[model samples]
Target: MADYQQIFQVSRNQAIKDVKEGVFELSRSAVIFYPKEGSFDCVARPWLTEAGSRSARGIWEIEFNHKLLRYIYGLTNQFTTYSLRDCGSLRNPRTIRLYESLAQFKSSGLWVTTHAWLNDRFLLPESQQKNLAELKRSFLDPALKQINEKTPLLAKYSIDDSGKFLFSIIDKQNPV
Candidate 1:
């Protein structure tokens, strides 16, 4: 509890709330995958399963979602890393998620994604998914503006002919 408070800079109550709620909430969410077959799949199974903690017992516990067993064991194709310092500059959580996702493609300096992929990535509301302008106004444009202003990565986006959102990410530290 004290460790959580110090690590996250939160009060005792906040840390308890985070341990009881925030941590579990993130684990309860599902992962979305866009397969090479040009189809999307929603693995509704969360990556974390509930192993309810008992405060009086002096223990906090959680179990990994069964589907994550392989990855958890260290067999993986993709490895991604991000700077916590860079993420701290962003106010919106979604923007941080976007920046992290963009970082996965940093080496290539490009990311082309479909509407369905974004619909799942953002868990965007139906109205925003249906309305491109709303998505741009409410999500993309603002996130990019923050990234451009605060991070070394410069983001420029356009909706290409195939109706895919194309992002060209250029790292100022190493333009590639």
Candidate 2:
């Protein structure tokens, strides 16, 4: 698919590998925390059936899970939106995750959560999780810088009295 070339700007060979990995990785379970609300623990069987690939086409032919489709298509009203262009160009994977988490709180322009919560969602390196300074220096600082530069969201963050991250995500598209 040109999506690999156009959106991600990756080489054909890299695209094939990425397509293969992404399809297989969906079978792995994940625990995602919502910045605004609850969490998701998806521990079900394979979300996609067969999930074979074509190297030439750089595509995975698979049967998607109905639940996954419904949730993604907004039937569940439990989804958030982000700029695909911005996400595709983002360098760090953590930046994309941070962007999505902040996107959910876009209406309020704020999100306050503990580092433990972010660790759980980002699944960051154990060393980073244990050390707050390292977490900020290694993960938070870089991700926030990317988010501010690449996305329409102007984000600023600080550690509150409770040692939780207080993020202010403001949409640059709409001026105050």
Candidate 3:
């Protein structure tokens, strides 16, 4: 099994905190990615690239595979939705840009998806899902604490195992 080194403690915390703040509006059952204690996966790194390179982080994007999205949807009974540049349609890139990234996918700029991150995967079953209240009381808030307990700059990106589109988070400095 492969393993994604938990990046710097600060980045890890920031990533987790970002997830907590981003999902408050949604119901508690909403399932976001949780980095396992030790997993060789699409690990989260600060978006640190210039404008064009595929790996460049400057464009500010996070990625995940299709299976991840389905898993999250299964847990929450609602798929993650995006607001493209405030337009309110998932199809509109500009509207989707208006919103921030889910902390689970640590980048802070574009609402995005990518193929590279999907090669490895984790999944959940419909019957294995959690209720909204239980998620709120248990997983949700604790995610933030988990971040604070570790450090402050927690961030990451999301991707499904199929390398399909899932979702991402935006950098705090540049609000969408």
Candidate 4:
């Protein structure tokens, strides 16, 4: 098996704290490229194990149906690879999901999606924001801030003339 090294930002200390306090919610999403369904949930299990004498560390293991894993890792051409650490560092689930989704288009450095898409994928309530501007102010900006500051990835977005969001990823090798 090939070793995959995608790190999530939750530190050992934080993980231990969360685990012990029973405050952790482990969530995973598998994005499907060409499909009737775009994404599906996967199970995550987090626990603490001894690292050394009088020391312990957190471990998070994900469980996926073999078919799903095969489809995601084997068959999908459109997929995002992100550090779990970065995702964990994000306070909002929407922000984390956005990061993972956008990371798929890092090579292009650009992604365009509609407000409706965001509303659907992030599970934003219809009563939450009345307009795009309000949505951007309340949700998008804060999420972008966290993604830029906490992760290796950086993002910026604009509302196009057609009212679609045009998001651009800053190239890590040549940041502006």
Model 2 global lDDT (CA atoms, 0 to 1) = 0.78
- lDDT score of residue 148 within candidate 2: 84
- Weakest 10 consecutive residues of candidate 4 by summed lDDT: 46-55
Residue 49's lDDT in candidate 1: 75
Candidate 3 lDDT by residue in tens digits, 1-176: 00111322235445444444433322222234456666743453322122122222312233334445555457564443422222212222221222223433443322354332211221212222334344334433444334323322233334457644444343444545
lDDT of 4 by residue, 1-176 (tens): 00112243455665456554432232333333444554745433322222222224244344444455555466356555655655656767788888887788788889999888888898887754457767877888998998898887889999889978899997564665
* lDDT score, candidate 4, position 118: 86
Off by over 4 Å in 4: 1-78, 173-176
The better-scoring model by lDDT among 3 and 4 is 4
Query: Higher TM-score: candidate 2 or 4?
Result: 2
Alpha carbon deviation, residue 140, candidate 1 (Å):
0.5
Tens digit per residue, CA lDDT, model 2, 31-116:
34344544644344446655676666566788766656655566447767665775677877788888889988978988999988
Error of 3 at 169 (Å): 5.5
Residue 174's lDDT within candidate 2 is 81
Best by lDDT: 1
lDDT over C-alpha atoms for residue 72 of model 2: 52
